[model samples]
Target chain A: MALTLSPTLSLRKAPSISDEEFRKLRDFIYSKCGIFVDDKRKYLFETRFGPRLNALGAKSFSEYFQILTLSPDKDKELASLFEMVTTNETSLYRDTKQLDGVRASILSKIIKEQRAKGKFELSVWSAGCSSGEEPYTLSILLHEELGPELRKWRIAITGVDLSPAMVAKAKAGVYQEYAFKTTPEDIKKKYFTPVVGGLKVTDSVASLTCFQSMNLNDAAATKRIPKSHLVFCRNVIIYFDEAMKKKVVSSFYDNLLPGGVLILGHSETLHKISAAFKPMMLPGAMAYEKI
Target chain B: MSKVRTEDLKPGLIVSEDVKSPDGRVILPKGGRIEAFHPMLLKGLGVTEVEADSGDDEKLLQAAADYTREFFSYANPDSPVLAELFLYATGLVAQRLATGWVPPTLGERMAQNVEHLSDVLPADEADPEKIVRHETELASFPESSLRLKAELESPKASIGSLTKLIGQDLGLSAKLLKLANSPLYNFAEPVESIQRAVTLIGLREVSTLALGMATINYFQGIPPELVDMKSFWRHSISCGIFAKILSQAMGSGMNPERFFIAGLLHDVGRLIMFKKLPYASTEALLYARENFVPIVAAEAALIGYTHTAVSQYLLASWKFPAMLADLINNHHSPKAAPDPRLAAIIHTADAMSNAVEIGAGRLYVLPDFDDESFALMGLPASGLAKVFADYETQAEQTISAFF
Candidate 1:
């Protein structure tokens, strides 16, 4: 019997990235931003950037690279590149254990110390706040903590992201139902007003927060921001190389007030990153206190 | 107005005042009836007591049932399958309430299911090859079955020539005749000859059956102790039969035999998992058994991917049609597939096969029936009972014929 194969039986084709082009693009991206793309991540780059190449009408990765580096609109292209590489997988009140720690220990301690010192100001910086959920969440926590006495204090909740698009989204403060996956229903109801596409952060919550576009890799730009009482830079530094991580951590240290708190993502640790801050074990989370 | 301990709060007792956590967050609102799992949830958040409103026990029980129904109503309100599943789930919840059994919340249940999975596939050891082998060892169809399949696929093939070809294998011919005479066909007279059986059952169906039988016979060498081979074949055949029945019922223009083949090989990856990684496979089984989670989730937790992905890999490696590969790949979550109608049929059929307790002797949990898929099919709830009844009636004969 003659063997006849089906004419339609072909493997799904994905655009391939060559080795030389991958090296050039990876190095270019790493120099501009701290994101390190190793050899194993060649497929990741290929699959993610293939559509971008097609969209820009560029034929090859090397051509896309030249366009990104040499074009007058290079900054805009780089911003788009950052948007693709950075994952914005965040939600309101993410990491409940960490939030619990913030509420029960960190916030409570801060409130008591402020009242004792007769200080009436509190500032929190949500660094790398992709799409603004973290800052809004912090604002809500502050509102809950201060309650009727909120009028007595000056609060500043600033959210910053490297991506302009994310910063704009954070400023808009509207999110789909997916953003509330981990959020308590009551919290959502209290802080958000129902909108056509999704939920809009209530004016009260929206008023308490501000959004800014800033790159963490740019030390000069980062230093311009005021030192904050609490800095949240969770899940951001994981994308950076070891040296970049150390630089960012030290900058965070410089950007925090004395006796301030810095919270990292749950999986992150400061063991090899920095020794400037002392680790404080809260109930269900960990915080680094600037002693 | 009395304060009740979180653990002592019974279902249907409404809170008169807000139950707040240590952080002053309202854990449960006033007028909220304590659910079966609420006590644990409250306790987990460090709530000790809630002020209960004055209410009768009968009123509370009624309130609890209403709450259970309301909870399930959030799942596709338009889907009758969802409605039926809701009714079933609510009944179970009511029974548990009566027995004073506090069911775990979905998150708790998932956490329990995946507690050990994290250890198996740690963050650092996420090697794709270790989790899922790229080079799968799937046996090809035997020469006779291949020729039979080719002949069946040929446009000019006739019942006479197909009957003659099938008659060459006396075992296959006899099985076909027996299946034709079985209750599945409901023939008044016995199908004594291969020609008449082939004519009655049609050339495509007979060939499909022969292919199915040949494949099952080929895989019969798998250790019976590792898997109950009879029950496995029964489940596969049952799924295939259900898929065919559902497609016909749904008025889908796709060939019923294609669905049959898709369903038959949907969990073939599980067999590969069992054969290749017996230890991990057994661990997945044990996790499912202990946690009351589906075997697929357990497999994904223990290994990175589920049997569905493995099956897709095997099918693709075997040079099967893309549609077949795609259907099996997305069978578990049919709504995600491009050809959702086909995937939904197989998904529903697979779930029904498991729900009716004709499953391969592994996990006893029912796969979640996708509401969107069910709603998309627009299958009347009235016809569902009849479809299931028809499947049940035909399943035994079909299983016996294939086995």
Candidate 2:
């Protein structure tokens, strides 16, 4: 039979955002939380906050912007907006190419260097870890790569997030089925076991990591965290403005030991932000090493 | 797992023993299921018996293999790059067959063809240039598109003017917004307004996209007997997506955006032929299918000029960028173009789209391929599989955006 095109696309129309509405929302969000939404990314304001607008039955982006600026529940709405934009609900083995680069180049070099120094301990930090996926993924990789030799090493992976609720979730060590979308079948089977609400990370895997709630913006609080051989603050830096980025990046640089590495999101670059670290381009990924 | 004779074990039965080749290398592992084709492999191994699971779904396996064999009969399965694709397609077909998917019969297809062709007319002109010249300009080409095209060419053009011009046509604005939001650009921020879309997507990109969509909408009413519109657009969109991806994968510092526009309109000449010379176009299609030749060859044989020629003329008349028109014209013969690498990208993209069974009609005919074009990209042959995989999701979303 001749194929009939589906009508799904035309059935739902995305309410267009006016330039004024976009600027208002962008400025408001930036002023409120310092999450600088670039003018080019005006669409993000619509797409991310679209659900909130629908839930409130707001007619237009302007109406939604008005609610955000004027309503008594504005604080609550802003929090929801923040969560929507800053969502890190990523699956296991997210950014496989970058992770592959880390395993092949960065981790191996760091391990060899540490071994040459006769240091058996390795400390890693997942700043804004978001429910522990990033840190736990690192633990899994380190365990898989190290194998039997892992027992002799003192490995510490600290996962920190600003939201206490997310820290609690990370502490629970449970993940739904969706969490393993990118995870290999053998890895999923070996590292996770079926539990009540979801699959629980195996004890051995869970033992390598810990979760805590600490705001990245707090200078003293960030410094209190241990100095690490590698710092992973991916996808979290997009929420900050230029000044905030420089500040947070400086904090990350200080948090890393000499010759330690820092990794950001694939699209995120230190271009025009800071020039302190030396950038290393790996196959399909990049890492910054502290001088 | 229990011991069973090789003859007794059917497809879908799990193998309990490691079936090995004459060289003693393991071919199938203990947990591997026996496929319909495995019997031949086992016989070649000179093994008469093997251990396997008890139950088997022989009928379902045979049905799947039969469906896949017929579907891909035209493609050369021996090609190293396409071997994985054929296997992937077979597995997918097998899953669908298990889910109660049934192949449509010849009579059903014919009936649908008659319905589609009911409105089709006879050929008007034989010469390609004359056909294009005699054909009137697109009556429905939006005034906004022409204005936007002029603006895009000007050095002093502002994003505000472009946005206002695009905003004049709600359909154009939505298309731009969807394209911007779609995984094509994959921008970190959402594209909400026409202004933002212009600033983010760029003036040339936005203009070419608008022209492409407008042209598609103009030819929407083409008789399905000539070419199913939805399938045609799907093929075109997929080719465009593949071209963009190929350019990116090449990492040769070529502009992928131009490749996308070129690929999207590569088959546009055929659309003209279908509209202006319906019966003749069908003759070419049937000739291609019956003779097992690429459609371009069939069109060239029957009509004396291929669709690319018609497409080039039509695009040039419509004021499309010269480079895009040239790319479309030389897609079937890439090495001859001024920028061979750029033309090679489109050529490879077109073939890849056809190899994966995305086409302008129900009949899937593999396009004539040139290994030199692929070689020009400098990408590993292994990357082809990943390219095909990426094309599926991106094409799916991009096509839906247009509709």
Candidate 3:
């Protein structure tokens, strides 16, 4: 019997980004948001934006670039684009060593300084706080430390991210199980209530934090943030080039109070970017202090 | 001591063995009393059965029989082959329980390997379409294989007609005959005639074999420089053999042929990646070697998706059965699978295949066995000795027949 053949399944090739288009988009993103996409990350851009092109009905990367720049709704498109390009990989108590350092050294020292100065208020900033884990973790740590004494002192934790979607999620304060991977069971039980699909941060923890959509590249907007006693800008600077890193680090420097601590991701460093902050080696982690 | 299905297990029953969770952490130590929450917790962790201390040998044997009956109560196998499989599995389970056997702990290095991968590749990037596009450059069922599948799917299709149709393709026919004569069947004499081969191996089995052979032929041109094709096939074929044996031992009532094909094709996505994205695949392999992690984790870090996810995408796109797609997708994490037993079989088979060192050069780190999956299989450490012995007895004949 002559076989009736079905059409062979055609292979769907991924859309490739050309050198010129890659450079154009890379430069535009860097200029607009301080995100540096090098030649090696060309594939990352292609994978992320390829589907966006299809969604927007753009024929090529150059056309997508045009839409991003020239469209009247460029602000909204750029915000959405920021959501795609930024890596929001974070969880509660993500780095145990750093968190331990905060609990043992940084928090203790800061509380001592505040008490000596007769200051009854404290402020913390969690830059690029994707979905609010860092700020919430800080709040939880403070709650644990203060216990009943928390009612006497006013604490403010401001979480800022470039992605409005993430800021919204942070405001909602609900997180899936992945967020609790590193969280101790006792802490989770004490601070969170079981909700559908995940745990919801209690009103107490939620009230301690305030979420805002602010781009780090927006100097005017960043200047408006209150000077914090501690600033966490972990894992956010790796995407920026050396120049952009310096710009962001300088902004962080200005945003922190004197003797305030700055914590970066474990692998990230301010070695070549900034000499203003002195690196402090803590028990299990490294932090930078503005003297 | 006797094995009891998890559903039949009541509170106060003594756990005879240390029950571990899917991630290999011990949840219940040996001689612990089952509490109200213990069974629920175990069920949540995908445990379906546990051995209980029955006090006496006779009582233990009775409990084992009762448990085995309860285990197979949902299965109403009409075929003699399936009935024999149930008997073999029940006997094995009882024998192990009688001896108070325990499974060996997985290698510490293997257990730690997947953590490194998970660290690099967070679970959020498992996009199905992107996975398919990135891995599969060009994949399709061969013309002859398609026709064979169509005929098999038809309700009125006969073995005689399938034989004739398959015979038209000399390569497929010869492959089927060789498989039939191989130690997988344990036939006394070599099966030279295609009709007899089809008769000896059921129509479904033959059709599955033909499709697998056609697939191997279709992708025969994947560059050797990108992958050691010989080692890849050796690992694949060993996994197939192991899966078939495991399915029979578990009394899963699934077609062993389907299990064989699923095992053979479980890593098809990895092969496609090697062919289409050679540079990236090489980087992933190198990363795995350098970091002492599994290749799947390296692939996830480098490419943002593991081969298992890619395999699921390809299988779903090709209109394979949803069960098959889900089985492949959760093979690496069997406790997450909706059908944990089937996933456990494949997962264990994959690990055992790697453990035998059939294709050691290509695989850097052996995949860890899911402790919950091992528990669900109800086999003991001694069972591994028997499986290895069986594989040694059949390995040469089977490899020659398939390769």
Candidate 4:
């Protein structure tokens, strides 16, 4: 009617997460491969992304998500958004039980089998090593088990992850004391010094572990870590599908030396993916050895 | 309890002055509270970001009380609106607790009071006896399969089913039986059979116990979702506790035990609706937000007839009390209340239950309330504050039994 029609901007209804934006964000995640998003994950998006949308002054997620993909002029914005989304708030020695298993089954077998075979050079790879905790924990295990032999031997503790943000955190070698909650009082005294923000991971433990950004899906990147004597990849692969799990398991198999061990999350089992390894149940955790 | 200072109060608020005159009725007061969010409910409905820390309860209650005062402005006898409202607000509380979810908004409370605001309230010249309807067995009955089943099934069926269905799952069964035999129900030394459970709970209450058993059964097998079964059950038991107290207040003739059962179940349909069509329930909740209708109407529009009707059928099928069925079907519509006294008592208590939450925690900021119907019953809203204090104590004792 070409009559003046001024629109009302807001309604009483709450600003909700849009399904289209949810799917775009979800598909973007699934497209990165090795993941499946279920209904439970819906709230996570709302909690994580909703604030970012409001900050951008976008009325709906559709406008924001479109801006995310189509805004070629906004590449830096895209990268920052991705960095924020993927960063998991976790600490070193996240769960001590699995670390204990690494010490028992993984190190003992490394000593008995690899130790005597003139393969005294034992390499342990900590996958998804957020902020270098797992790799440092690996260093602690080597010091605990191999003792004097730890420094004498070529013990390379390689920490790898996909997130550039996490990789930098790992390289920075700094953490909050809360991050090392499970670190025994003696270990906290030895491995860390309380600083302004949190705790600083000492260079002694820091020197043993090298941090790098490597996507699991990038074959060339993943292949760089060759023949690790022991692999501590606990609690990370839970977000992956069965096929991705098998792929990662096979990758871990390839990365390990013959009879090298693979440690996984407490809730995971390797029986379905690979018959190549036998599960060695430890007192506190479970591990698998290459047959 | 004593009121605290202004500085001790939270920011962002209004207040409703106590407006009830010596003759009893006052218009709506200021500073109304909304409702609580059982955590998952916030996510399901997609409204997580709310006010800071949310503890301004007394301000909210005062607001709700004020809204009531503004709503009627003053009493009008021709207007059964306030009477109907007391009925409806009472209905909402009972239903929400029974369903194990919180009603996101409290438009229902406002609507319950003002739908007939034009109608006059209790007359100053009106005899006190006439104003108070004390007929306990006033609920009507009709020949329907619903009514027949309501009569046949053992009120004890609730206890037996608990033992059977929930018992099949060892953990819950043990918990149910343990609680059933606990001091609350007072089974001399813990009887084993459903008959014993029925006998202990008595015919009047077995239905509610059965519902309790059923709720644990529903939530147990499934993985944890937004519905916190523990908190949900506790809220339902809280409603059950309030219903029991209010039933006693309805004078002697009313079989308050039946009132307790119905009050515990008025919103059982919501659980089924939420479980069956989560998306639909979410939509209905959305509509509830848009229209300011309570959750029941939201449920009815989404799933054709409120859960009250569905629960009525279920109870009827299970052979519960006839009045219990009406209580479920008409719990929210106090004007349609067949047994007005029992209905009013439960209705009032339900509104007050949530209002107390508003008063205690700033979860929902409710307006202050007028006191005519409550005073007629010898229980003003102030008395409700006292009753709630007592309820808080008793609620503690009873919650563990049901949960």
Candidate 5:
């Protein structure tokens, strides 16, 4: 048979990130910003940055990654990059299973133990408080748990974030209805008052919490945070590299009382991080107890 | 006395001890009798559970034991090797039932009320080798997997070449790197590069894992009617997790990943049977369920050979690693392997996965546990709790990573 071949088009439509490009970019991002983008989320890089690459007229993901590393405008681009990934969808009752576990097994147990020692004080540090939903939710839980006896105890719930803007919004104590996606209607009616644009957190819950801007990487700043009986750092450590995770976990360990607990994200574990905290399995979640 | 959630509370439960609110107020005193309204009252105060005598533990355990016995009708649960497994399985069933886990019921048969399934699913004289030969598509392995297999067999293969080969296949590269970072390995840092992943998760181990993933991905067109793909892979991944954990517990110097690979592909022959001989396979499945016999026994009775024999021929024709081939071939009869102890680890792992009901792979009847192989290991049944938990977590991660 005579040679017969069909022609093909070799035009590039959209830039796709090769495996090597993904690895290189993630490594650079982790080293510079402590945000480790693992392989499971590799597709996220392309989806997030594809439009940016087209805007910049970059040829491929490798080219875009090169511009990010070598171009003089890298710092400006990095700012936008961080801004894109950090608009979190934190809600009133995120991870309800873990919250349920805390309410069921942990809170009362701690209260009973504290009463045994004749202490009427409770402290919780909401590391990476992220616009205040977490600390406010926690305050709601504490208020609901303690009921009318709340005034008898000295309660301090400190909420901190790396961004000052987020801290400012958190301190505003205002949220739209979208924030109550998982919140029960009764809880919303009870704990929140309707405002002009949204519902503002009632003062009872707001009074128990204080928000400020603080960097976790800054050890000195972390040290200034009050010692806590419980540290809520869910879904925050995934952004950090190994060294940063160790530093932040060690800081949590140092800031917790002897019998305090540390709760990470529902899926996060302290494996190969430290042996100082003993893992206590609750109903559907795990809490790390300071040894 | 048992811990009852506030939502599940009933009247007439007597409190075992004082139930206190979060503020140190005693909600219910010791020996206090509970009424219907107490559950809601306690829930309002955030009391999630109370220790009360429900007087149903014995009845629940008895029901669970009966369920377990019916579940293992195909296996000799009273055998020396299986008695402890059966007891532990009963406890797990009871625990799950207490937590409102409903057992899956085989609702209705498609070919309703057939007195003899053979009338519907005609018999076939399907030789194992003939079945293997008929499936021509599986013979053409994925290109990346083929190259990796060859590189593994070659003495001159270097890590650089291996990395380059894997990097070319984006799916495999992503899977391998993700697996390296998964809790199964618990690497100290994020594994971002293929080279680092290979180095960290051993050169041979990573290559073998990639091979396994590629092999699994190649069979995408298998009809859903033949099997539920997620359920099948869940069974495979759970078996692999169990094998790896069991190997670690044994402290044997062998590479645990090899056991994982063997367990993962141990059911490859069944997949081939389903693809090549759907009618006979359906007959075997129905026969096993109706007669309360293992699928292997049903296959051997109906088709002259089990899926294990089919797997042996397929792997041999593909020139797979000799040890892996032998492990898959003799999994059903581990006593015949050269290193019966190693083969027995996979055997016991398979049994444990089935006992825990991770996924049935549409094999409703439990497989026969090799008593001789299990007796060779000298492991306590108590240790299996940790193994089962570890397998569950890792299997979930692996499934999510691939699918």
Candidate 6:
């Protein structure tokens, strides 16, 4: 039986991880991913990956890590696990209070300003877009508010993750009603269709967005990417250590065009590392504007 | 150990089992192992496939191509210079023993007489020792060089009736007559022509040595790459030196110098294999690792002969004494050998030289020579150590001139 998780990855039962193999596995990942997750946090990894371990029928954590090392395709599956280990479990318009600020402050300004710009080309990159729900919701919000004008605008909603598996699911572009936790019902009814297994994201949502497997450490490769007018690098940086947070923020700052927008999780900020992004505190919460 | 089945394939190979694609979703239609693997995998990754071949070889040629691919993949493209140095250095040592030096250590009575010329020769005109050392030693002897491969295929003759055949080649005829009269024998001076030399030297010694000498100089034609050509030759010469010194210490009277020469040329087969059949050598190494077989056995199977046999044939054709050539040839097969002295000497010296990182520093796979031979030869461990120490200390200038 699998254990329930609180907006987090979980396994049913913890597998015993020997100190030696754990060190080696940790070292391997640190070398490859540039992420130095402490192996001492046996509880963290075990609790998170237990279900996956049992489900995959791997004898132990070492065996699971060994399987991850088998081939590039298999390694991609591990990368997806790494991405979802902390669970990027945001629902449609999650943190609804902040979503309200996004409507009143950020989105309202962009929609109003685009009329003067003549041809507004908006782009958004939802970094660590696990399972595709967030970007599709953003797509639904844009389509509902902007209508045919949104179609005329060269809009891009790029979702990127290190996990090929999550990226695959993201590309398939389907979700269930559970994904609509903060989404308004009328919006869901208008945007999704009742399908055989789950609610299939409409053709319109899939058409507007592209999902790709990308490593944040490999920023140079994805730097010339979406050329996003807005970025939702929320929740992803929390699991990262300070250095990774600084790095992810710097990459985000480097990628955005001037006079664009950057959003972060409530606890995340650009105060020290990213001085170029000026804070815009609206009624509900804060958003960042590119200088 | 047996050769891994997958690793032995090459182009134009036929296999009994069908191989499936890596995912096992598709079976290659009626396939032999894809012909060449290293090139194939590189190509498969190369093409943004709808699909393609490795252009070097198909995945399955024989059983070994996959192993070959796996080996090259781990091989750094920059090429590890150490491995290159090892091949070159060992080659130089073998080269020097072939023609350059005839050591006091390996000297027979003839060699000993020349070595100790100060005690015996006239000293009024010139220091005979200096003349012997500086002048005669460096003088290149007129010797025929031929591939033992050809000689192995050549017709053999019985000693009693081979004189006519020996009389055909002038150099062979002259060397035989000279050797018959060189006071090397205890018998009366009955030397006249090639036939007399043939009649006296004994069939096994004459034929094998003739083959050994010619074979060595053939290896000399194959140049090796070494930055300090001197050091390279020196290390090989050292292996030879130690082989000789150890042979005497063992009281085997195996003609230490020839054993040294034998030890020096043992790896020449490796060179010949490298130059003539590179993939075969690579496959040999891989199959050895994969199947846990010693690489030599893999080489023997892939090529027609082992390094010992090749070295033997080569030396025999070079007109070396059959005793010396056969000694070297059977160095790895001592118990059955009539002359295990060279085998003991070469095997011990080769191991020591490599152990001390002498010629080719690190071995791909260590040789599985019989250690029991050393005990049977009555050579104590201490005697072996002394020779090894001597080779280690003195191999420098010795290697300089030839390699």
Q: TM-score for chain A of every candidate model?
A: 0.94, 0.76, 0.94, 0.84, 0.77, 0.83
lDDT of 4 by residue, B1-403 (tens): 2332322222232234432334444322334322232223333443322333223434343333333322222122122323333322332333343334444343232221111111011111112122111111232222232322342354444444434443444554455466566534555576675556656655435544444444334334422352335544555555666777776654676555565556666656555444443334444444443333345544443333465555555445444555666666655555466755555555555555544343222122211222333444555443453455457566665666654
Candidate with better DockQ, 1 vs 4: 1
Model 6 residue B245 lDDT score: 67
Winner by lDDT between candidate 5 and candidate 3: 5
Clashes of 6: 44
- After superposition, the stretches of candidate 1 with alpha carbons farther than 4 Å from their true spots are A1-14, B1-403
For model 3, state the Cα shift of residue A17 in Å: 2.3
**Residue-by-residue lDDT tens digits, candidate 1, B177-274:** 87778766788888899888777767777777676665556566677666556777777777888788888887856567667877886787777666
Give residue B216's error in model 4 in angstroms: 11
Native contacts, share recovered per candidate: 0.00, 0.00, 0.00, 0.00, 0.00, 0.00
Instruction: Give a tens-digit lDDT track for model 3, residues B99-183.
Output: 5643222222122211111121111222546546554445565778677767656677778888888889998888878888888
Candidate 4 Cα outliers beyond 4 Å, as residue runs: A1-15, A73-87, B1-394, B400-403
lDDT of 5 by residue, A1-291 (tens): 000011111111235667798788877766554666655444444545667888988988878877887899987676566544454446677656678889888888888787788898899999999899999999999888889988888889999986666878899888876567568789889999999878899998999999987768778888998999999997678667678889899999999988899998654568667789998877656789999
Chain A vs. native, model 5, TM-score: 0.77
Candidate 5 regions with alpha-carbon error over 4 angstroms: A1-291, B1-50, B99-125, B137-139, B358-363
In the range B232-288, model 2's lDDT, one tens digit per residue, is 787788889999998888885566777887888889889878877664575466555
lDDT of 1: 0.69
Better of 2 and 3 by TM-score: 2
Q: How do the residues B1-403 of candidate 5 rate in per-residue lDDT, one tens digit apiece?
A: 8787776554555789898998989999989877657877999999988887766744565655666655455454335445555555665666566655666453222222221111111122246676666664445766777898898777887789999998898888888887777777877899899898878877888778877777777777886766556777777877887888898888857687888889888899988877776655655665555444567766764455688888888887778888788888888889999988889988887887777662221335566677777767777765666676676567677657656
TM-score of 1: 0.46
Largest lDDT belongs to which candidate? 5
Assign candidate 4 its CAPRI class: incorrect
